[model samples]
Target: MNKPPQNSAEMPDYLKARRLHLNGIITLMGDMKKLNARANKNAKVERLTIDAIAAELDLIDLQLKRKCG
Candidate 1:
């Protein structure tokens, strides 16, 4: 059988997955930003969620920078 994913649980493109992931995070952040600007937005929860997603994106960036050799 083919080798299973080593870097992520669902994504198999180890080398380029970060770009994909960052794009997704960026999209999510944009949506959250919009929500935060709305009248009914929960400020505290939005702040926490955005912070968590940002941290996860940073980790993905760090992983992408690691040498494969």
Candidate 2:
């Protein structure tokens, strides 16, 4: 009989951190989407804030992949 493959559930601290960071980025993106839907064109500040958040999320995703890989 063949044994089941091992899971990465036992990953190290760094991997865990990366996973958490990725989750945070996703959550932030969801929030930004909601805000964008309600925000009017005159809301320049809100648009800028959303743009910054998106940039940060991209950076975090890249960092997480680098660290986890």
Candidate 3:
């Protein structure tokens, strides 16, 4: 597992940017999810993307939790 910065101040620029990008993706995914639900479409691609992003966020959260706790 990749180690996170010990603190917010210690985080690198790239990681910060990455987190922001991923957060934006999450927002867009939310819209896509809502649209898919309304249209009753089988959004396999969207589902896969959501799963991948969730997995990545979970990993990052686990690392951050370890650093903080």
Candidate 4:
């Protein structure tokens, strides 16, 4: 069976921004998961680790904005 295509909603600017931010977080999380799987202890504490941490923080901020605004 074939699947139906998704429709694009006319979302507000904030919602669009939130979606973009959340997508970025998901991508970052996936990258982090891969890094954690393949990397040793030293790599875990590198710049990529810091980037993932910052991405998590940004995700939290976006979530809060979504909830509060």
Candidate 5:
């Protein structure tokens, strides 16, 4: 990753950024999932990008869930 992930919530802010990140990731994953479901499942480039995003999202979700971090 070119940029380090930013965390804005500290003390008074408290998990605000993490929660928002989690939510946004979830929304994106859901949209990707819908696309995956509707997709032809045969295109190489399309499948590759979708798979990559899904894999990355899974990692982020696991980290947020305290299963990987």
Candidate 6:
């Protein structure tokens, strides 16, 4: 039988996952800012897109808090 891999004390699995999640959120926020900059062209559509992204970020925040805390 093969032994399962182990996580080191320096960096646990959850922490690693949290880091990835934070990075993704950072990217999403950056994209949202970019969209906001050009939002004047299509205010209605871009507003919806920004709202969706904000909702997603909120969900991710809740998940990270539950999982990481």
Per-candidate TM equals: 0.53, 0.44, 0.58, 0.39, 0.41, 0.45
**Between candidates 3 and 5, which one is better according to lDDT?**
3
Per-residue lDDT tens digits of candidate 6, residues 17-40? 554665676687667767778556
List the candidates ranked by TM-score, beginning with the highest: 3, 1, 6, 2, 5, 4
In terms of TM-score, which candidate is strongest?
3
How many residue pairs clash in model 4? Answer: 0
Candidate 6 or 2, higher TM-score? 6
Worst 10 residues of 1 by lDDT: 7-16
Give a tens-digit lDDT track for model 2, residues 7-69. 544333544555466567668766776777865565676557657766766775675567467
Distance (Å) between predicted and true CA of 3, model 1?
13
lDDT of 1 by residue, 1-69 (tens): 345366453543553565576568768877867766766556777568767867877776676556432
Worst 10 residues of 5 by lDDT: 8-17
lDDT of 4 by residue, 1-69 (tens): 223224323233444465566567667867876878756566645557667756766765775566556
**Stretches > 4 Å off in candidate 2:** 1-42
Candidate 3 lDDT, 15-37, residue by residue in tens:
55566678899899888778677
Off by over 4 Å in 3: 1-9, 12-17, 35-42
lDDT of 4 at 61: 70
From the highest lDDT down, the ranking of the candidates is: 3, 1, 2, 6, 4, 5
The predicted structure with the larger TM-score, 2 or 5, is: 2
Output the worst ten-in-a-row residue range by lDDT, candidate 3. 9-18
Global lDDT scores for all candidate models: 0.63, 0.60, 0.71, 0.58, 0.55, 0.59
lDDT of 6 at 28: 79
Q: Top lDDT: which candidate number?
A: 3
